[model samples]
Target: MFSYTGGVVLFAAVLHASWNAMLHGNRDRFLSMTWMSIAIGVVSACVVLYLPLPPKAAWPYIVASGLVHIVYNVSLVRSYRRGDLAQAYPIARGSSPMLVTLGAAIFAHEAIGPLHALGIALISGGIMALALQGGRVSRAGALAALTTGVTIAIYTVIDGIGVRLSDGEALTYTAWMFMFYWLMPVIFVAKRGAPALWSPLTETPMAVGSSLAGGLVSIAAYGIVIWAMQAGAMGAVSALRETSVVFAALIGRVFLQEPVSAKRWLACVVVAAGAVCLGL
Candidate 1:
């Protein structure tokens, strides 16, 4: 189970980075995100229908996860609109493992070794260094991204607990959580305006294609991580999956034409090394 979970975590890290890159490629972040949400909803709903229901105890966490994910998506979209993905994605994702580690300590009474603490510090420092590049970090954008990180940590812990409570139906819970997660965007559209809702439908084919890719990769990334947690320690799974930062930095440099100084590249290496330490 540990070996299988490790493989899943590695695969999830790649897919997670791919979807983030797709999101970064879009010009209209909100519209692209809406389409991605719809795609995820459809896929998750199909999975939910085919799989058995999760145990009753898992529903509370599932619902809480849905609410937390809504905040994460909103903050992530806003952060991307305000900052470059290289800056935002690393800070956003990098903060999560540490937050999850702290949450585990408080809620689950889980203790971390000195090595894990060192890894967390390295990861956090690397992200901060990356975010501080260009001599001007948008505080609002950074805060929004950091908030997204916190929400992700919340949901990660919640879902981790949910999977444990589930009677061998982690996949089913994951599918349903995603199915209900669509409600956030749906409610946002309904409250904001119909124009915001309908605009994505008229987007160009290329934009729609990118959105679809983002949606598919997002599902694959998260689905694999959730499955992995069922078979391994949640902290290790979370830490390993966050290796997405390395890919995100590379994508930003290559595709977004963002300036990647030698300093940032070194920071990225530090983050990757930290993730390896956490995994070990």
Candidate 2:
């Protein structure tokens, strides 16, 4: 079980990074994101038919998280518009752990130690460094990515609380959240009249397949992490999952032809170190 947990965590990390890469590589990020959300909605629709609803106690958190996810998705798209994947991905991914830690301390009365403080400082410093890269990362990109991270931290806390109140049916809660989370993007696209919305899926088999793959991978990544948390050490699982920062950087450089400087590599190391500290 431990070995399986580790493998699952690794695969989840890769999938998480891959989906982000897909979003980054897409020519029309907003459209791609809309399709991805619709894909999630389609899958969730099937699951919610048989799964029990989330407990009433979890509804508020689920709703709040759904709303925050919309902000996250929008910010992510905007960040990718103005920044290279290598730069934006690390800053966004790196920022979340410290913010989540601080949020826990404030909202859940969690204790903070020297290590936690150090981790927060390191993450903040690394993100600041990325933001201050002068011509490398645009201000719009930095702000958008940082905003994405903040939204991620908020939804993560909400999900953590809501899942506990799920009456041993965390999957059901997740399904419902996915369903609700997709609605905003779908509505937005509808309002603007997306004439080419279904063209990619209907006219191009590869597009359909890629969209399905992205959605499945996205769901699988989160689902696997949740399973790993149940079967293994949560801290270890979390730290391992954050290795996606490294993976994202490599993917951007190798696949997307994005320029990753030595300084950015060092920044990634600092970010990963901070994540490790948070886990510890």
Instruction: Specify the poorest-scoring 10-residue window by lDDT in model 1.
Output: 1-10
**Per-residue lDDT of 92 in model 2:** 80
Per-residue lDDT tens digits of candidate 2, residues 245-265?
Answer: 667878888999977677877
List model 1 lDDT by residue over 1-280, tens digit each.
2365666777798889888888878987877777788889989988888888888999999999888887788788888987888888877887888788778778766777887777677877787788777766687988888888888899998888788788878778888888865775676678677777666567587787788778988988998888777755566677778877877787877888878889888998887777767766
Say which candidate scores most in TM-score: 1
Whole-model lDDT values for every prediction = 0.80, 0.71
Best by lDDT: 1
What shift in Å separates residue 176 of candidate 2 from its native position after superposition? 1.0
Q: Estimate each model's TM-score.
A: 0.92, 0.83
